[model samples]
Target: MANEILVLGATGKTGKRVAERLQKKGIPVRAGSRQGNPPFDWEKAENWATVLSGIKKVYITYYPDFVVPGALEKIQQFVDAAKNTGVQQLVFLSGRGEKEAEEAEKIVINSGLHWTIVRSSWFMQNFSEFFFLDNILAGYFVVPKPKALEPFVDLDDLADVVVEALTDDKHNRKIYELTGPELLSFKDTTSIISEAINSPIVYEEVDMDAYVNTLRDYQIPEDIIGLMQYLFTEVLDGRNESIKNDIEDVLGRKSTSFREYVVKATQTGVWNIQNGQR
Candidate 1:
């Protein structure tokens, strides 16, 4: 019966923004992170009771991704725990076109709690805030699916929708497929970034096996590598090329376009090369 809302993965890309929005609105927020008070970790169920002790609602953003093995079990366990701890609502961040994610969504939907599912496409912030940033900074965007057209969703827009869902009961029992206004391939995205930053950025397409091997060579974790492979091979196979109006439906405004995101990102100087380093 507590008023504070717990945001799992509170330090992540979407969770961080959602938590900030809630705090700015003067809502009580309990950040769910290893460093948080009553710290929460997905691999550690022992901390769940402490983290959910006084939490009324929870914003769930599973780490690594929901597509991995054993994800459904973890989600099931967390959902059960949330129910036991008097959590009233759940706003789950899910991946677009991921079967495992959808299955996890099912678990929340049937949990007897107010629930909203934000099934999202690839985030535009990946170019600036995630693994792709290294490639962008290096001026070479290499991947297996350079020509796959994806309607990348802006994290800002996603955060807005998530915050609305968390605060508004009207969004409960809804599944919002969030996407941007337009579709763009990796090549097109790189070109836009290049123009925005006034730098030459190249897009290279390699085979999936080579990409996986390259990740291995870089010492990336096997789970992360498997995720990348699955994403590039299955999810990004033109399955998420279409845009959605869910953002506008939720926020009553146009979803941010990829080009618009690129323009704003450039102003932040994230793509700026400083002294031969990113």
Candidate 2:
């Protein structure tokens, strides 16, 4: 009967959307992140105690990814803390096809808390909110192309699912693999956006080493580079190349397509060139 929901990573792509939805429904939420109440920092154990106080449920979205080294340990510790601090329900935003992420999911499953796993595919918002946005604006988005296709899930869809799990007990102990309606290669994704915005954009496929070198040139952190490598090498081996129906099963409607997302985003003028740059 705990009504308070603690949304960790509250400023992130899905967490922000989840918080907005919860607030709209008049649900009580404690925004957990450096930008909000109690200022949750993943590396700071001291921040954990206060953030979990008076919280009956938690929505956990680990930053940078759950596959990087020590992520499993961190999630285990965080879940243990949540259990000890009166948090009874946990909804985890999990990465699909990530071995380490799967391990983290297991930790949550074994916890005393009632849990739901929102195992998700690549997010379509990466183009608008993350590093890919700058690349998209610059007209050339580069990546180490995965041979297997990715069905990029919409953040809106993800938020919808997360909200459902956090609010409903029926979703407890279930794992929902969230994906879009269609499979797309990296090139196809950029092409769709180009068509949507009525502007030319290109997808440049680099070898894994080349992508690593590019990150190195920018002095991107080693841990981040490790993630990029893991994603490109391990997760993209066609294991998760297919679309999943779990979103439709849970939300009772087909998840938004990439094309639909791009069209909607286009209307926001987020892709419009600004101040002589994108």
Question: Among these predicted structures, which one has the highest lDDT?
Answer: 1
State, as a TM-score between 0 and 1, how close model 1 is to the true structure.
0.96
**Clash pairs (backbone) in predicted model 2:** none
Residue-level error in angstroms, candidate 1, position 149: 1.0
* C-alpha lDDT score of every prediction, in listed order: 0.89, 0.87
Evaluate model 1: give its lDDT: 0.89
- Model 1: worst 10 consecutive residues (lDDT sum): 269-278
lDDT of 1 by residue, 1-278 (tens): 34789999899999899999999998988989998998889999988988999788999999988877788999999999999988899999999988888899999999999999999999999989987887788787788855468999999999999999999889989999999999888888899998888889877889988888767765778988888888888898777879899999999999998899998988898888882244
Return model 2's CA RMSD, one decimal. Answer: 1.8
Q: What is the TM-score of each candidate against the true structure?
A: 0.96, 0.94
lDDT by residue for model 2 (7-46), tens: 9888888889999999999998889888777789888987
